[model samples]
Target: MSEKNHQGKRTARQRLAVEREKQKASERRRRTLIVAATVVCVLGLAAVIGLLAANSGKSSKSSTGPVVAPSGAQGKDSLAIPVGQDGAKSTLTVWEDFRCPACKAFEAVYRPTLRELTGSGKLRVEYHLVRLIDGNLGGTGSLRAANAAACAQDAGKFPAYHDVLFENQPAETDDAYADNNKLVQLAGKVSGLDTPAFTKCVKDGTHDGWVDKSHQAFQAGGFSGTPTVLLNGKDILKDRTMTPAKLKQMVEAADKG
Candidate 1:
């Protein structure tokens, strides 16, 4: 072969080698980028899952330990705290969350009427406490408050203490009731509720599991929200015109029936 031709062929081979090397390097860079992006996505998804799991743990943990129903708790699974004579002709079932503002509002409006009817042996109230706000607002206030109320039930002072809780309910976003001391202090407002046993029960979360079970029952009932008020198995709040007077009239009608 001529020297010039040999030189040209060798130069062409060298150039092709360089091009191949460049292409391989480019492919390596692309693969590295793809791998790095995949890793970031995986880590992000893991973080989200971990956060969700942590929240679930907090909620579920509140209900851990024993399911001790309060003394004299009635209804299915002893979930309902009964007020007034069981033989009353009319029954009102109230599913309430202590941390829920709507529950507080309902209590504010209907408390007097409930007291009157219950005292007269015309209506009985079956109160089911739940920890809904703990799940939604990320706190233990609802659970703590419900457990404390159960303690009052154990003391035979549920009605007075229950009214006190609603009367002194904190803002929806405020978790003041989560503090055991706060609950005990509020118990002082009840005539004879702040005994040593009551304090211990509130601090120890004696009825947490019961409250959790009540909440689960609330969920299973497919109700929309808190302060679910039912009269004689009919949802009363669904009536747009519902008021304390309407409730009284309905209970009177049920009593007559």
Candidate 2:
């Protein structure tokens, strides 16, 4: 071959090599851009998903709307439903859940003594409703019953209705109180308690926020369980030897003091 032709062919091959390298570099840049875009999209989608999850968690954990305390409710934030004379000398604070079997047991044992003391104006009871069972058992019975009790409180029959609930409490795992109709039917046992307004309050969940707030406070207080009975800021049930007679004696002593 002629020397000029051979040199021409060599030059042509060099140009081809340079062109192939430029195309390879271009392809690499395009692939890098696609990978970067995919990562950004995935990160953005992850961020949106995280935001939704956070909002859902907040909605489930926090109470919504205004807390409507029961009529005649007294105490910090009006979370307590008072059941006796305000001028009574001693205060009995009861943290309880209606669906709790232990609470029903406590009420069954102490109701007589409490009634007697409160009747004589020697003791006042501050009942704080909680929904611990609802949280533990995956049902709304505790919340519904507490709200119904608050409704009865509004009707000025809290003490009577409270006793009725405990006396007729269903099994702990029954979750029967979740039915508003059943609660209203039970109200029929209390004379002058099953009014239209009371029914509406029970069914509409009027005091749900107040009950939830009280439950939150109970949780924050680090209490271990339900039917937490306190007398003048002392945990009476912790004594393990506490009885109705003992509770009466303590209240009388406080009154005398």
Candidate 3:
């Protein structure tokens, strides 16, 4: 081959080699970028899954609940948190849950009237504590708060503690009540409720069984939800004439009849 032609051919081959190397480097970079992006996405997804799993675990851990029976549970009706004379002419059975907002409202408005009637021997009130909110909302607040209320019953401060809890209730979705310490702190607001025995009962969930019994009774009563009130066995919510203002009148009529 001529010297000039040989030189040109060798130069062309070298240029082609350079181009191939460049292409190979480019491909490697592309693959590396794809792998890096995929790794980042996988890590982010794992973090989200871990967070969700941790939240679920917290909820599950709070669900096992306490074991003691309520101190105020009465005969044949083991769920009664009674607030009136033993043989009053009318029995106002109230099914309430601390986590329930409607129950809070009922307590805020009608509780005074009921207490007045109860205090005056005009009516008997059996407050039945229920915990359906925990079953529906996936938290321990309802159960824990109910357990705390039962502890108050043991200290002879149930009604007062009950009012304090509703007054200081967290948001419906919030699990603040799941903390036993907070419950104990709230108990301090009520007279004679924050004793060491009461504190232990609340922390250990002494009346969780009684709370469960109240729930069973609530369900067996054919009621669908909380704040279920009855006057001498008549469903108050289902009655058309039962207004918040007319509660006293209804009690009077029921008592007379």
Candidate 4:
């Protein structure tokens, strides 16, 4: 009888040990699952942060600051056109399309010289905004952007808005039609524009006549491509060869003539 009782106690103890081990195994599995889930969440958060940082960097590099004249002419004249002294003896009228990459490049290179000339009273620069690439690339954003610029000109914010547009113009693709809201946002980036009026003008096509007039003039002038500069309404420069030094020399020669 004593032997039987000993066997029963031993079996009970063995069963309890097995149950304890099972419980331990379950706890370990739970901990492993929790750690894996935590790792996944952390990795996702890191990826999101990295993406945002990259986007922020691109935005900063793309549009740095307000366009300023070159350092040498600091106190002599305001870099902003029309407000500066018209030092130029000859008038330079430029007809450009906002979507034209060549026009943007020209602006990048010649903006400073133009500003300096305008400031020094050596030239009077007039920009006639035209929508040459409206329906072809990105629907009407290109045209809408041009009209917005004219609105800015009316508000005396042409220089600022013009610089901003060239700075922010998208690639030649269908994705460039971002909507009128984007146009308003871009106009707001310019310093002196009246936002409400500018928005209204862009939406209602307030300056369509200006664009039409510019188109007529461009057609009359035989401008097949952009970056066309007319010095006193005569074609003087066409493409990449129109450097600042060359432009200065041309202007000086024209003055002599």
Candidate 5:
């Protein structure tokens, strides 16, 4: 072969090799994009399913009751399970969701102190119920559990039922409270709570509307997270130095103020 022709053939082979590499890289990028899109689609679908499942507060065969707002309930939209005297020194408004694990922890740690203060007529707590987890993570437990607690309130057993529900709160992802029967079963553990009225209310989802309304209340209050505790309408957890004991002192100061 001529030297010039041989050199030209080698150049052609090098160009072909470079072209092949470019094509392979292009193919790899397309595959990566496709995989990324699929993952995004899957995550979106899961979030939608979660929201729908949480909002699906379908009632089964349970008891019936007047779904009127309980007496002393905060506003027309919220339930008021007040523990202390009406004219107490301080008001502790709690914005909590039933399915929030953090809320369960808050209850476990501060419930006793709360009860003590309220029982002693030094503080009155307004239990502001919200279903943030249901709205965020997607499950009906927050709604169902809140409805059950309202039912307990109807039966004059709010405190007992509320504590019990938190005590046995299932894992955040678990749909334990989705089953109305489970709610009623928990009520059985609370004296004077397992009754025909409570059963009817649970089955009919009588309080579900109020639960929805409470979520609206939480949003209107300019809050974004669960277990949002306000002592006399001031955020306390932001300090990170707040302990149960410190909280008591803070409330005392607020009361004096």
Candidate 6:
């Protein structure tokens, strides 16, 4: 073969080899991208499964039937009394569980706005204590605390005792049984409460039936969670994200209606 032809053939072979190497590099990159995408999808699915599991554990069954207010044997208008009043045309009632962290958070965030509205007569706020966490958080202790607050209400000390309980909620993982002494201490902190009577009521479960009645009322009202607020007998806020700003907007809209 001519030297020129031979040299040209060698060059052609080198060029083909370089092209093959380029093709292999492209294939490797494509495979890497596929694996990366598959891993991301798997991670995303796992995250979704975890979220669903968490929510399922917390979800409660909501009642779809008509709501029945508490019986007159308890008291007339017992379900509708204003725990706090600003004489606003609208009434905002909240159903809460003392052991619920979300209820504590809602109280912390909305107390100021609630005080502003109710104190100024622009709103009337009533709180109904529910016992959702009785089994998990503090069983009897949780129920006892709620019942104690009811006794305070009987003695017209609801607001003070209510504030104290939320302010001093035990650590999240602290069992509800740990709250008994603290609840008694809180009752004592509320001036004007019949301390001895309140103590006896809590210890002897004087208000246990009342607490159960309140929970029944909450279930009747279609609530399945703490911090459920009813604005003027109409269900309004149910989500934990119902912030003060959102509540204020709700009140304003209700006023317009």
Q: Candidate 3: TM-score?
A: 0.71
Candidate 3 least-lDDT 10 residues = 37-46
Task: Report lDDT per candidate.
Answer: 0.81, 0.80, 0.73, 0.60, 0.72, 0.62
Q: Where does model 3 exceed 4 Å of error?
A: 1-67, 75-77, 254-257
Candidate 4: regions farther than 4 A off? 1-87, 175-178, 238-241, 252-257
On a 0 to 100 scale, what is the lDDT of residue 211 in model 1? Answer: 89
lDDT of 4 at 222: 54
Q: Candidate 2: how large is its RMSD?
A: 28.4
Candidate 2 residue pairs in clash (backbone atoms < 3 Å) = none
The parts of candidate 6 lying over 4 Å away from their true place are 1-77, 177-179, 233-235, 238-242, 252-257
Over 20-86, each residue of candidate 2 has an lDDT whose tens digit, in order, gives 9997676455434433433422332233334446776465444634689999998998999987789
Query: Which one wins by TM-score: 1 or 5?
Result: 1
Q: Please, what are the lDDT tens digits per residue for candidate 6 over residues 140-200?
A: 5556667777667666677788888878776545655345566777776777774787777
Which residue pairs in model 4 clash with each other?
86-121, 87-120, 87-121, 87-122, 87-123, 88-121, 88-122, 88-123, 89-122
lDDT of 3 by residue, 13-110 (tens): 99999999997676455434433433422332333344446776454322345435676577455668788888678888888778777677667656
TM-score of 5: 0.72
Which lDDT value does model 5 have at 237? Answer: 53
TM of each candidate vs. truth = 0.76, 0.76, 0.71, 0.61, 0.72, 0.62
| Candidate 4 lDDT tens digits, 1-257 | 69999999999999999999997676455434433433422332343344446776454221212322221212212221243445557778776777766677667657887887666666777666555555334256555676677667767777888888889977745435347777788866767565677788767766555454454455455554555677777765533244565676766676676
Question: How much is 40 displaced in model 2, in angstroms?
Answer: 51
lDDT-based ranking, best first? Answer: 1, 2, 3, 5, 6, 4
Cα lDDT of model 5 by residue, 21-90, tens digit: 9976764554344333334223433454455477668552222233456545664444556767888878
Q: Give the TM-score of candidate 2.
A: 0.76
Q: Looking at candidate 2, what is the lDDT of residue 252? A: 93
CA RMSD per model (angstroms): 24.9, 28.4, 26.1, 26.0, 18.8, 19.2
